[model samples]
Target chain A: MDVAIKEFILAMVVLDAGKVQGGGCPVFHAENSQEQQKTSLYLARILDGVVHDLENGVLLICRH
Target chain B: MEKYLIAVIAGTVSGFVDRWLMLRSDYRYYPTYPHAYLTHLALGFIAAGLGAVAIPALAKPDYVAVTFLVLAAQQFRDIRNMERETLSNLEKTKLIPRGTDYIEGIARVFEARNYLVILTALLNSAVVYSLGWQYVFLSAPLCFLLSLRLMAGSHIGDIAKIEAGQLHFDGSILKVNDVVIKNVGLPAEREKILREGMGVIIKPIDDNARLTLDAPGQRMAIIHDAVSILGSKVDVGEPHFAPLARKQIDQGYLALFMLANEPDLEYLMEIIKRVPVLESTRGTTLSSLYGRKAAD
Candidate 1:
């Protein structure tokens, strides 16, 4: 639950729960489409987390 | 003889009339498949029949049949359980889940409905047999409409004032009106809300309203309705652009933010106004305890 990061690592890979697929460095699994959209914005924009989609429900979220 | 027959007819008619008029396919729909309908309908008929026949059975100088009414009560409770189970199963598969409180409320209504059916039937039968069959034309519709009126409960609009709010960001924090929704530190996400974001601020009229709207599950339901009605503009990967209900619990106010396909403020406000008060999240201390204090 504590998603806090410290002494930032260059890149780390995390599995998405919602199964949204993309090229983002760290993809998140959102409960539904609306949630997926919010997660995309938060991780990709604010957190500077890369957000991309793959045909697989997996979305990739990573740090830029 | 013929009087008893008419009593039975009136009772059964009254019960079915309740079912027919009140049964609807809407946002909080009960499964309307033929199987579901037929099952409830059949149970309703038997309940009506039991109520109608109670007079005759008692007239026959047999009191033991009164026990049947108790059995019928038991049966009705089972119907509530059955309803809750089915809806709970269906919730698992839904894109926007109706929360547990909402589901339980629907289930309770389903169960309570059968008892209403029985009450209507019994009252009509008693009137027909005791007064005369002629009274049924007047009594049946009265009972049916009464049941319908009884079924209505609280709506969001009843307790809150809803107005469209502007979506703005200070730095990266998103604000719907004065309420800070979340710290959206992302520039792209902030831009999306400011450009495409539409929102509503719901201010509770009193403490009761505050208590009812405070539940996270209830707020989620409101957000779900807004999104389902307005349609989220963003697609699969856009988590930040999704509809959200951000609440100020102490202040008894909540704000909705969304990047909707059609950004109609009035329409979205109307949709939020109609969301039903969830069953499980039923009562509030505000109406009684807090209400008196606030008035004074």
Candidate 2:
């Protein structure tokens, strides 16, 4: 799916095993580009992190 | 006269046999035509000629001739550098580039094979010079066979168990065997992976095997070689659909997921079986020896 660049990743939350562990790796957190959400999603997948949309601007990644 | 004559013939034959075994294009159809084949063969002949004279020269009172072998080593180093540069340049033009580690491995193999030719020829010459023509006739074949054996390195099959695995979605999670590959939220992507993906589980036989498979570069080599042989169904742009190896870190097992052009499980497995175990990635529990008593 094609995600527009305008939205940008608002923030990333790391889940250790399933629990929210606060702000995740900054490398995956896009400061002002929604285009980075796609990248964050891909990196999360590589790490085998369970990703979820916690809210409108935040992404949650659960690493097992 | 017969001794030196036997050295020339047997040494040349031994070098040719070594080159014949090594100058292969099985992994990557490199050096594809008459030009490349002619070049390697000519170089092989030269290497043989150099080695054929070793015994005759060394046996003479002047030992200065041995210095040429040392010089030959410097030339082989250049050969390796050339191979590495050529492959690196060629890699940029390809869609799925062979990573630097694999490129380095191939370059090293080419350099070492030349030395193997030298060793085979020199040994054959020595045997003929010491014994006689009859001994070299037998010894040459024996030496050729030894070179063949030495040249054959270990493959993934030698150290790991590779088996076909099933891909299934647990809720929104995509998994191969028991390993969680990713969390697929899109049903379309899930369907695409399930319908097209070939899943394989590689179980390392020991701690050493686990460590070898653990490296990202080693896994990339496996994926590149397998996809190159089978033809990748996806392209460089499709990062989401690209072949990937996900490690089950707790147990140190690796699961490979790929959607290749062929999608033939048997073909994929056969190619994976033959992937050379990367020597640079080899690791063992004994590297640290923290758990063992010193005396043992």
Candidate 3:
């Protein structure tokens, strides 16, 4: 049987480094909104997850 | 011997024809392959033969042969298990899987159809044996009509009203009417969704209908059926574009959102209306005393 993680945050992309603190999932800091969006999109595709905006300058990639 | 031969032939032929009529390869594309058709038809023939022999076996007072009918029933039960396994395995590869409830419903239908086939054959044979071979024409059609009536369950249209819902992004959140469908982070993806997405609101006619639509499995079935017909923009990595059905907790209505390949809102609503209300998800809350009292 194939098994995979689901409904869990796989990674995070944030515009401001101070917005998100350290957590179990990897957090990527970007210079601006464009970079943050690009990083989140790439992370989402790579992790087979969806990008959800916390709307606090932080975007998280989660599998569901 | 001649009388029994006539009875069996009449019964088997009618029953096999009934099975063929019921096996439809529609937009769902199930049982599409010729091999699948062969499997079902072959099993149907066996069911028909068993049913056909039953009356004659009884006429001869051959209690031993009649016992084999019990074995045939056991074999039919295996068909349900076989169908469930095949469908569940297929579910893994589907972009929008037919939920377990839908799979169970389909599997149960397959098993039940065999039983219906047996009844048709038995009835036809009984008519031929008692009445006359000439009465085969009348009995066959009558049995077919009865089976057809029993086969049809219910459609979504019967329980709800489907209308086009407004699709818009509330900031990064996708909303179908007032229902929040999903949260998308990408600006480009959100734009694509706005351009291609379709939304429909399903208003349940009554409390029972509301409870039926409340089932997650039933919602999954609606999405699966709609996507199968309309085609979805969702791919392996693009989970955001996947079709979703969410209920409005306050009013008990459902809102569906999909970024479809065919973005025609009218056809999407039509497809949703035509979706079969799954047997397992049907709710009968109003039938109970407490539920009826609470509805007031």
Candidate 4:
């Protein structure tokens, strides 16, 4: 059977560098909210994932 | 032998016609290809032939010919497997898939349809043989009507009430009424969704209908059907715009959210209502004594 990662966070885009810590997935820190949304959209498109907001300053790209 | 010939012809013709009637290529887009139609028609003809010959083989006391009917039944089972495999293979490429429950229901219907053809043939031939060839006029139409009636299955509209739901966002979380659909991180995407999105609430009429809607597979079917007809804005990598059906949990109703190319609420609601209630996911809770007692 073919296997692949799903329902897992592929990458993270954060507005505050201090808000996120080191994890298995790569985290990209944006200079501002505009930069943050752009980075999330780019990451989501590249990773073939979806951008989901955590309702904080963090945005996650997850494959589902 | 001459007497049996007319019976066989009458049975085979009626059965083949019954198969042809059932092989409709509707809005579902299944069996749309000529080759697919040809394959099913050929199988239906074979099934009909087998049913037609059964009575004559017994009358002739040809025990060996009677055993072939069992082989025909085995052949029909393989048709179900063939249908299941083909649909499952095709499922991978679909943006929104008809879930396993729906696929199984469809495959089972294909198998059952052949059996119905056989029954129609058997009835026709039996009538023709017992009462003379003149009875074919009466028996053939009766069998056709019977097969049609038997083929009719319940649609979503029969069990549930569908209406337009309020599509809005609470912060970044998209919702249909109070049911949470999904979270969108991109503000632009949220705006597009708010502008183009449509929502519908499926309210089950009873506990049985609620349980049917509760199934993930059944919900997937509803989404798939609606998207297929109304068209969706979802693409390969963009999962945010994917049509989704989520349960309200407490109330046992379903909230469907979708960004459709057409974006017509009335058409979307109509499509959802017409979705075939998957047989595998069909609930019979109300039929059980305990379930009826619990509801009271």
Candidate 5:
């Protein structure tokens, strides 16, 4: 990941963490826009990978 | 002979009234079993036969009175049993999953309530038979009216359940138990995300049906977790957020990464919307153009 993307991802991590700590609720409605729908699909796909990697200890996050 | 005719008239009239009340009432489900409806008619005929057989056999009206009183007591007990069954059903349905099963519960309750109404009619028949013909005629209509009131109360309870999102249409189909459910997600935590990943889970409030979407990569893993959260036999599928286009693959990856961090459905939707347009024109053209247009 690029420095910028990593930083952006890091910001999101912090934001999500705040929500969890604050007892924030999850969203349920379907996406309205095509772009958003695509991004959502992509994000779902990636997390899908991370979950797999974490399962097998293949994640490169520590090395990175 | 005349007394028997009177008893039969009273019982038959009350039975008809009870049936009409149940059919016309707005109770979501009938509490009475269909067999109870048949029982009402049978009771009417039997009451008439008993009146004929017993009234002449005993010269004193007091003996006939005792007979009616005993019958009324028996019928009342049956009514109570019916009411207990209805309440039990309500309790059982409260535990039933809201959705399709909920509707089924409503139907079951409705049937039970209708049965109670029939029991009331039977009691009224006994009371009317005990009274002489003139009084029997009067009692029958009054019993029917009371049955209506009982139904009205049950309907009110039904409406309350419908309003609490505890009841609604399952789809295009309008059904009693089909309830609209909103599943709110808890924002992900850092450690939790590391363990569970970013994803949204949808679960039916009452049943073992659930859908979990982990942010893109190993979505299957999230599905596995959902299998346990929702239990067995739930059909799991992926969330169709976007198309797998070739050009925006990197943007897709970025969106997936962001989703892993946030995993909030609304936020994910907003970010995902920006992905394609952001990817287009080197990720800045449309917003810049709009910004310039606003400035100009």
Candidate 6:
């Protein structure tokens, strides 16, 4: 696969991972104020996971 | 002015039909899909043209009346559909916001425009009835222009409200709530040759910072306006970083858009990853992230 194409797929795969795992975080659906706050924190964590992978260029593969 | 009137009629009818289709249970959130919105608008325009030509040939008044009735009835039927979905939770791409009551507001505007069109047509047609066919013909087109002007203005207003954070972009903000990275890039020698309003901002990796921000329209302009007024400061991150500010939503969502898409997505992300996410979220930066990369 071309370098760009490979990179594209990897990036897409990572995003899809976040979308699938997002599953409406507990804080995203929390009823109580505290639970809601916690849900927001959890949501942040999920986003962090997604962002970290994207920044590292983890999806890109270059031929050595 | 005549062409403008034609555009008005076309736009009004287009806006109404656009709203009608959008109000459907399966379709309320559809407009956020830029491709889908364009498709629907084309469809609406075709329907109006067909009605204008074919209806006059067939039953004349009844044809036009039925078209209005069908459009109006469809919108009304979708009111209950609105109750089924939590408007705030749904996010449709970057153009429209998720939490705001856009569907309802859009529907209300469409209905108001519909009545305006019908009322104007009726009054004009009635007055023209004693005159000549030319007069009645003129009436239909006239009402259309009025409706179009109103619809365009309303769309512009909706865009403004979104920027003000009076409308959408809430869900994304709630999710990626923190300010992670910031960077500012000055307009290089190349950008000086580019258009009047253009610049860039770069941020680090800990933030896919791009995927989060997309918003309604007018606010996008406000951000553009701010960038133009503040010069390099806009790019450096001065005012946009403000909580729920229009540019805040725009910048974040833009980063998200530039980050998530394929091909060109990498272009923006590369710049964002290299540059530091600046503190103030103001100042003008480089003209184009990837554009410069290609030249290099």
In terms of docking quality, model 2 is: incorrect
What is the Å distance of residue A44 in model 1 from its true position?
Answer: 6.5
- Comparing 2 and 4 on DockQ, the stronger one: 4
Candidate 3 residue spans exceeding 4 A from truth: A1-4
lDDT of 6 by residue, B189-233 (tens): 112212222223222111222222233332232232232223222
Tens digit of per-residue lDDT, candidate 3, span B204-288: 9998999999999999999999889989988987787888899898999999998888888999888888888999999999999
- Which structure is stronger by lDDT: 1 or 5? 1
* Winning model by DockQ: 4
lDDT of 4 by residue, A2-59 (tens): 8876699999999877888888999998999999999989889888899999988999
Candidate 6 chain B, poorest ten consecutive residues by summed lDDT: B159-168
For every candidate structure, what is the RMSD over all alpha carbons to the true structure, in angstroms? Answer: 8.2, 7.4, 1.3, 1.2, 21.3, 19.0
DockQ score of each predicted structure, in the order shown: 0.07, 0.08, 0.75, 0.85, 0.04, 0.03
Instruction: Please give the TM-score for the first chain of candidate 3.
Output: 0.87
For residue A45, model 6's alpha carbon misses the true position, in angstroms, by 11
Q: Write the per-residue lDDT of candidate 1 for residues B1-296, one digit (tens) a residue.
A: 58778888888888877776666666544567687778878887877777777775676656888787777668778887888788778876665566777777777887878888888888888888889988988988998889889998888988889988978876556788888776553345566678878878998887667777888778877877776677776444334455668786567699888778888888988998998878656546656775768744
lDDT tens digits, residue span B191-255, model 5: 33234233222221211110101122222222222222223221122221111111112112111
Each candidate structure's TM-score, on Cα atoms with residue i matched to residue i, is: 0.78, 0.78, 0.97, 0.97, 0.30, 0.31
- The true-versus-predicted C-alpha distance at residue A15 of model 2, in Å, is 24
Q: Where does candidate 2 clash, by residue pair? A: A8-A33, A8-A34, B233-B261
Model 4: per-residue Cα lDDT over B148-209, one tens digit each: 88888988999999999999999988999999998888999999888988989999999999
Residue A10 error, candidate 4, Å: 1.5
**Judged by DockQ cut-offs, is candidate 5 incorrect, acceptable, medium or high?**
incorrect
* Per-residue lDDT of model 2, residues B1-296, tens digit only: 66677777888887887787778866667766677777777777778777877887788634777787667656767777878898888987776677888888878887787888888888888887887767877877777788778778899988899999999988767789998876554445678889988999999987778888998878888998988788875544334566778999799899998888888998888888898887677666546676234313
Instruction: Give the number of the best model, judged by lDDT.
Output: 3
| Candidate 4 vs candidate 5, TM-score winner | 4
Residue-level lDDT of model 2, residues A1-64, one tens digit each, is 4544442333353322243343434524354435445655675556544344443344544442
lDDT of 2: 0.74
Positional deviation of A31 in candidate 2, in angstroms?
Answer: 26
